[model samples]
Target: MVIGPDGCGFDMRSPSEMEADDARREADEAAHAPRMAVTSRIRRVAQPPDGYLPLSLFDEVRLADPVPLYAFEDVPADVTGLAVDYLSRVARGVPARDAFRVPLAGARLVGRSADAERLLAMVDGFSDRSVRAACLLCGFDAASRRGPARWRAGRVIDPGPATVYNVRRMVARTLRFMDRVGPVVWEGFTFDGGYTDRVTSGDGDLLTADGLWDLKVSRWPPNPTYTLQLLVYWRLGLHSTHPEYLRVRRLGLYNARSDTMWSVPAARIGADAVRAVERDVIGYADGL
Candidate 1:
């Protein structure tokens, strides 16, 4: 019924609007007029956790990791998510309402991988435009009118295999360059509303050696807006589990096509940035 922020993807059925739309469709089908369809822009509202601050340059765009300082202050777990939940249903090969009954084996489920896989699994739940939305959300593809949506088992799913391969290759190269990368702890994960599915911790999500590592995926590239995202997860572990923030304090960003992993310093990240994110978490808790 209701589409994304943009109000397209549905047949306009108001008597006047439908008449116009149908006439346009018929004209196109009959080669009487150039094919025409209505498209409307969706207005975006700026909203984030109090402590986290806005991720965009100002208000023109959104951030990558809105979660870094998002305290979930007033956000209901169900604040807004149905497409994502549907994808999880398809990916796990189970109904969304049903509990995940399958057992885990050697799967390193969590973080980016889980998001990507869930997108892979859920095909039917999305409309044509929604697929594009997911790709943009994951940084795999930009929202373009052209290009066929890569369907996964008949769903409009395409996780840009080319980009995924690129990420894999870069990580391997980084490991070779450093020569002492830590064993990735696949700490068993569950989808826990990071995007509709809640991925539980302790199960191995992907981690770099010593908790700091480089992520080189064919993505839109992480920016300051999204960096706090990694920071939040990092803080989760830092504040709760590790606390010492030891042995790991770096992140490298590699373009999906590029070879070099640009190392990031966990310690070197500015205090203001850290404070901004901390404020997000605290603000949520404090209900600010």
Candidate 2:
């Protein structure tokens, strides 16, 4: 039973309708609210990393785009990224099956969760086979809300062989890197709206023993947008009630596709730059 969006009660709108809706939403929020995600404020703030940091971390930029370790025939980067992230959590200490409960619950709510569970049961451990299953599961989870309505119906999802092939390879590279890192002090942690109510919620990937880290499973290099997002996450951590972030002294990015890492010391990010983001980008009130 392939469920269409209609079957799942998801609102189906044409591109124009969606665009108009977005325009209206933006217009309504324009006066009182700022952009919510850290990504939104990056270019708008116009605060380049060079404006804030003394040294460039990605100085030895790979001129050549990295050759993929495995062929991703049909899998999107989003599903692959989630699979790698989930596998990383499993590599640390999270139970493999349990980690997917929330996403799976969405399927369960619509009586489709059993199919995913049965499919996942074929793999017993964190093998390449398991990676493939995780990828499919992530795909199904992504599709549940975002995909066409028919996809949401009681359908058995096949994340495709390419997802298993590519994500397995990516996870192998990522695990090797993750093993060398310190213990995870934080995982998928979100922040309080300390600076602005308009920007309500955001989360960081990992705060390991060494520093704060963001995982990038994409083909792109670390641009200014990526750099600013990390900076925002770190600053948000400091502003939040969590005192543990005070001990974090570095920001890092791990590119799973290229098996590479880039980082900058938190100390290099000047206080004035951070203050500017708070005041300008994130809309912090004076003396707050």
- Tens-place lDDT digits, model 1, residues 203-270: 11235556543233333444543344445555444544343334556644433223334455565565
For candidate 2, give the lDDT of residue 248: 89
Give one digit per residue, the lDDT tens place, for model 2 in 34-84. 445564455566655464433375333232235566544466676678778
TM of each candidate vs. truth: 0.35, 0.69
lDDT of 2 at 159: 61
Poorly placed runs, candidate 2 (over 4 Å): 1-35, 39-68, 105-124, 127-129, 140-157, 192-195, 286-288
- Residue clash pairs of candidate 2: 3-149, 3-150, 3-153, 4-149, 4-150, 5-149
Return the top candidate by lDDT. Answer: 2
Best by TM-score: 2
| lDDT per model vs. reference | 0.34, 0.66
